[model samples]
Target: MNELGLNFLDLGDSDKLPIILIHGMALDQTMWTPQIPVLKEHYRVLTYDIRGHGLSEVGDAQYTYKMFADDLKSLMDYLEMDQAVLCGLSMGRAIVLRAYDMYPHRIKAMILSDARSEADSNETKYWRENSIESIKKDGLENFADELVGNIFCQFQFQEASGSGGVNSKHRLIIFIRGISQPLSSSQMMHDKIVNSEFKIIPKAGHMSNLENLEEFNHNLLEFLGKIEF
Candidate 1:
């Protein structure tokens, strides 16, 4: 735990350049276990459970990306880190964007996988609301079909009240997303955040990281291997 009391797994040599990995919504650090072996050898990799998920304590108030980003900033400050490679997947991507928005200089690079630059889509919002209503009316077991299909980790980049949003593309960005999923919004995201190598993992869906760990790890290492420390 650092400043926010977020349960975290901090590994590798302290002197190494830091690489912070943020997991998707409803996911814990364990989702990143597969990538740790390689990352530990070259970088100080940090993985932490976000609030209300995994082993982290749940906050009393409503959750927001700003709050999540602040927690991350606090942890980094406590660790005395000036900059780090920030990697976020799905919902984690939104948190990453929030942190970058608040402290751009703190982020050295980014690894965004299967994420959008906006909030839940209409279809997603409908199903999400239905799930909530079903749970409230029938309890956890009422709907036993076990919601099929992939629940993607997504995001939307918001801006200040009068400010235009993040328009320019980011440098050192690596975008990896699954090809099986609907990617209508991907072009929009890429257009705004220009060229960063985009790799589509074959035979994978929204949960590309877990679906094809071997391929994901390979691509990730290739990217990290080339980056200047």
Candidate 2:
């Protein structure tokens, strides 16, 4: 673990460009198992658990986007990396965005899976509050079942604004079922960012990487090939 109490695996050659993979909420770095072996061959791969998850220490401070972004920056500084490619999933996507906002120059590029870039609406906030209440009222098992039920349902398509901005021109947006976020967000991001590519892994849900590892990795590698540093 680094100075920030982040449990991480630094793989691949030290001289190579870095790729940081951030997992979704409630998930640890192991979620990126499928991509590591392949990615490590070409780039320096860094996979770590966010604070309060996996082996990482849970500090007393309330967890927020800024806190997570700061931790990411600290890790990069500790690794002596001036910049790196940030790839994230689900809540991890939000962290990647926040990190870029905080330290744009440190981000060489981004690969976002199941991406979303908008403030939570009242309905979304209520759903999250209810989820917390459900975990407290019911149990982790029940909550897991309910969450699975929600994730595996038919994909619901929604529209979102492309108002979010990023400093980097190179980005790869990947998604499965357009649930939990609007499909237009990807389109807007692709439209806004130069050298950006948008891709979809068919016959998959939110966990598209796990559901269709081949296609996901293909899109990821193809995107990486286009990047210069």
Candidate 3:
């Protein structure tokens, strides 16, 4: 409980059922900034830094998405939450799916943004392995700079605005900074968790929520509304 507590950020009313927001790899709760204010108006929102990222202390490098799901379950137990909505992006999405598989009873609904459930493409896996080797040899900073260009749509970077008129440069900057921070080897463990249940968000690159906020929000809100709370 204490270990999990150190990783989460509790926002909005504690009296309400929690809505946990799990961010993608490298990024932290701050990535969910746009959704917080609006979501808090209707539900208690909980966001967290995955272990080894953000304010959370790094855990074992030999971890899987199921382990992350366990962390969420542990956090919910510590907070005394019975069930909550799980919203995730990219790596976060994998965690949510694993959580659903592990403790479906604890999840009221799920929202996966800018993510897929299938394992990384062989090409992507090769790149990830190469990048990890490079990072180990060089540093996270250099690796992050090289990675940013693939994170957002070219139009978003060029227009300086994301879908639905959301500013992307600011988001991109924040994301880059987060990724540039120290990260543990646990990130490589994600490669072991072959995702196969993911659905792609249209017109989104990697940062789907920021890339297509309007559509993402509408789909998210609609899913929330349809669920029997």
Candidate 4:
């Protein structure tokens, strides 16, 4: 654990450039279980639980993407890493983008899976408010099904924000999306990052990396191989 009390695992050669994996909301670093062993063979890997999730300490302050990005930067500082490739899944994508926006020099590249680049709509805001109210009223476990249903079944995830500062020319970005999920957002991101590569994982849903580990890992490794790093 670092000074922020975040539970993290740093694996592979310390001499190699690192690849940091950021999991989605409601998920811990363990979600990257399948990819860890494979990735560790080539580069240093870092996986950590976001604040308030898994074993990470949750402070009294309200959580925001900016804060999460700060935590990521702080973790890098603690590890004495000057730069690393960032791989984010779902809500993790937002955190990655925010981090790049704030500290572009620290990010060597980006791998965004199941990403979204749009601002949240009013309906999304309403649903988020309703979900919070429901969770508070009935507790997390009781509202789990409903929350998951809305996010997965209905495909109503909170959209991303603060992407205007990300410039495509300076970095190599890879976009990975599930074949079953909506592709518009991924396409938008791909278009935004002209030099970025995009891949679709077959027979996968929102959680593409977990649902189709083989294909996901293949794409990841391919990207890693292509990069100069």
Models 1 onward score TM values of: 0.82, 0.85, 0.75, 0.90
User: Which tens-of-lDDT digit does each residue in 18-92 have in candidate 3?
Assistant: 788899876788888877777787789998888767788776566677778888888889888998888877778
Instruction: Count residue pairs with overlapping backbones in model 4.
Output: 0
RMSD per candidate (Å) reads 6.7, 4.4, 10.8, 4.2
What value does the lDDT take at residue 135 in candidate 2? 73
Give Cα distance to truth, residue 226, candidate 3, Å.
1.7
> How well does model 3 score by local distance difference test?
0.64
Q: Which TM-score value belongs to model 1?
A: 0.82
> Model 3, residue 51: what's the lDDT?
74
C-alpha lDDT of candidate 4 relative to the true structure:
0.86
- List lDDT for all candidates, in order: 0.75, 0.78, 0.64, 0.86
Candidate ordering by lDDT (highest first)? 4, 2, 1, 3
What is the RMSD of candidate 1?
6.7
User: What pairs collide in candidate 1?
Assistant: 90-153, 117-156, 118-155, 118-156
lDDT of 1 by residue, 1-229 (tens): 4447699888999888899999986568898998899899989999999987778888797788899999898888878888888888878888877887888888887777887766677997797678767867886544434432234323111110101244334447777888776675654566556556677887666777777778888888888776676
Which should have the higher lDDT, number 1 or number 2?
Answer: 2
Q: Find the 10 residues in a row with the least total lDDT in model 3.
A: 169-178
Q: Pick the candidate with the highest lDDT.
A: 4
lDDT for residue 133 in candidate 4, whole number 0-100: 83
- Tens digits of per-residue lDDT, candidate 2, 1-229, equal 5567999999999999899999987678998999998999999999999998889998999889899999999999998999998998878888888887788778888878887656767997798778768878997688887776566425322210222666444444433333333577667666676656678776556777766678788888888887786
**Clash tally for model 2:** 0
